[model samples]
Target chain A: MKRAELIFQSIALITLAVAFILFWNFGKGVSFAENGLPSGPTVTDSYVVLQENLNRMIPILLGSILLSVAIAFYLEEYLARTGWKYQIIARQIIILASIPSLLYGLLGLYFFVFQSKKGSFFIHALTVVLLVMPRTIQSTQMAIRSVDISIREAAFALGAKRWRVIIDHVFPHAFSVIMSGIFTVISRALAIAALIIVVYVWTKHTLQSGDTFYIPGSAIVLLLSSLLSSVLSSFLEAKTNWD
Target chain B: MQSQKTDPILHIHDLNVWYGKSQILKNLTFDVLPRQVTAFIGPSNSGKTTLVRCLNRLNDLNVNFRYTGKILYKDENLYAPQLKAAKIAQQIGMVFQKPIPFRKSIYENVAYSARLRGIKQSDQLDTIVEESLRKAQLWDEVYKHLHTSSDALSNGQQQRLCIARALAGDPEILIFDEPCEQLDAAETPKLEAIVQNLKSHYTLIFVTNKRRQAARVSDVAGFLYNGELVEFGQTEQIFTNPIDKRTENYVTGRL
Candidate 1:
């Protein structure tokens, strides 16, 4: 909430908005108009193809991302519990999260595509899932850890069951933390898609690739989401009093 | 508040607790009477925290925490295997030494427990929130800001908000684990006043390191030393005529 930070964020946001306007204008400004009658070879238009790819590809991408989040909830519970056995799994998750995403993309290509000979779209979605799941799990762990212990204890002492305590007390307190980390991981996952798009498009056997346009759209999406999430987490963190 | 000599609601029968290999509470026995404030006074490392946590089985959350003996709540053995901590907690609510209001609105903070208890009517929840806040002596300060995040309140107010949250559940007993320890001198009296007023409706148990606070607030006082209960009796008698040497030493400031 500092003035300098606020100014920086505002400037970044404005640049993003201008970038979005430029993309939208690109979609509509293709025709050369004379006497208000437009004429051109509209053969360069790939917007329909782009929409087709998005409609087909987006669902798989979102499904994998949601799967990661679902797994993260269970993983967070394991991380929160006490025991050396759980600690071993926690250490493994930490190690997996620390490994680079590029390596994961290669592993996905090997395991989900080359080894199994699956379709390109399915393999790509699988690859992205592998790339993002570890980071999501790591973020979920941190979110749960950040919740104050006293709040959970207070709920337990009120006769709230374990799930009740988590739903009512721990999860609400940790919601911002969870959302921020999940959003960051999603952005990173989208960025990974952008990074691997070259290989992804090549593998799909499509020279009429419309993904070139998807890159800029996703970049804007990534930037905005990460920014929004950071703002949300910081707002929750800064709240100290109401009266 | 009930008389200090009333039949016990919670009977602790030689309870012992250990954190892994290290012992925390050693052969502790006591009884908590209904609607009366029972204060536990002890120096550092005397297991005051561990003792209170045992009442609601909050200590069970600690994987290393292990205990023996029996705690009877209304002739039901609280330490029995079939008894879950969450179930025991329905009758025992706690306010910690530090204020821990959730990142929520004032009404939401108090209404949280009521919702968990399966009260779905908005009107009913509103009434419970108002009544709980009123009982905690915080409604007048917070009524106008019911929808605002509790973080805006001062430390004293935040602690009171916690009390209101606990009260919303209508638990039979309310435990104070050194509620004013984290508070400053200016905020202490406000918390003490709330604690004093709370004894009329709920069974109040206090764990404090402050000698004067124990004498001022408690109907009965128990002295703990080195993980053992040394003496327990009427607060006035415990202060004026302690039976054991360790109790005398602790109360008279000789140790």
Candidate 2:
């Protein structure tokens, strides 16, 4: 395999392993038994935690992915145009990509948990949304940057407008790369979502349920969903969009 | 298609281009005659590419690209606010040094521009595709596989496909920017024959650094050096007995 593919798969595998561990820890923490299990009702207890974790993270993950892609599209176009403003916007994207997700958790703690009602879904989801955007923007930038000048010139020489050239030629070619980036961001979202949920649960002192061990199954779901979405989006885009 | 003598196909007057503060073209003035091959020959970095881009407003894609001049096509200033770049490009088709097939079928590659103008009927599109491919001298090779991906063709075939794509648009003028740069020894002659046959119907511009190619293909040639037009006249005169000392020096390999 190529080096880039190797690295992509390696990072994906490592993250999947880490996600599994995080979920397992959550499962153990929430269990009513001595060893990450319920005393008399294992199935019921596991189901409840599963439901709770799904309810908390799924909406945030899906919503943020959509929002991030939208923002990335606009930002990519802005950066693709020839202007001095590109450097400034690009620097901002760099700062955003480098920012730690933990900072978002801290912000979520103070603003979403403390300022507003404690442990609200909207606030937590919003925090994850904010976190997902930067990398998505960066991914979009990289994809747009990869667009060959010859492809664009061919379209332009044939009398395509700036928007038409982007929508027709630029976007389809970038779609595969952008979809991979989105998957990476989605996986990152799963990690961030897990981190935020822990912070929220610990602060709220909800120790009655076996919700702590729910992270493993959730991570598996995230990994599968990431793969599924990547394949689906790319297949659909390549089919419908490209000439 | 042209009837007026005073109205040349294209007129360039005092064109200057700058990329971020560095000037690339300087005070260039020239006229492109109708139904003739006009060659622009210059050493690398002499702004040959930049000059052709000005004709169809392709340089507008450059972020820091700024220019001062007027390029009049068919007596209309191409830079006029009322005129869109798309409108200019529709009439002026360009083929790049590298042939780029749109990752589509051979037929679709030729029909791309026609479809942009809303030509949807497959029959009509087929006719356009066949005519264009015949004109580019590519029909005999790839006619059986028009439905297959264009990427499968050889570099020479791809260049011809690009010419067919340009021709499909029904453009009045066709500009070739070093179309032979990527072709092999055998493929160059294939393209040369097509170009030689094309000037009877279209105002063609050939931008190349090769003096031999210009002498073989162009009716008239312009030599640009350091962003300035050194000489512009009949290809025979410019190649055999150039009046300008710089042109003579550059042609004879002294400079």
Root-mean-square deviation of every model: 9.1, 9.1
lDDT of 1 at A2: 100
Model 2, span A139-239: residue lDDT tens: 87788779997899999999888788888899899999989998888777666655555545453455445434443445456545554655565456446
Candidate 2 residue A37 Cα shift, in angstroms, is: 11
- What would the per-residue lDDT of candidate 1 be over residues A118-163, giving only the tens digit for each residue? 5366665666666667677778778877877777777777677877
Candidate 1 ranges with C-alpha deviation above 4 Å:
A2-7, A13-57, A78-80, A109-122, A199-243, B1-5
Question: Can you give the lDDT of residue B60 in candidate 1?
Answer: 78
Span of ten consecutive residues with least summed lDDT in model 1 chain A: A37-46
Q: Write the per-residue lDDT of candidate 1 for residues B1-255, one digit (tens) a residue.
A: 346457899999989999989998999888888878899999989999999998888987887888888889988998787877776786688998888887789998888888767888999999999999999889999899899999899998898899999999888888999998988898878777887898888899999999989999999999998899999889999999999988888888887
TM-score, chain B, model 2, is 0.96
Fill in the DockQ of model 1: 0.49
At residue A169, give the lDDT of candidate 2.
92
Task: List the candidates' TM-scores in order.
Answer: 0.79, 0.82
Best by lDDT: 2
Residue pairs with clashing backbones, model 1: A240-B151, A241-B151, A241-B152, A242-B151, A242-B152, A242-B153, A243-B152
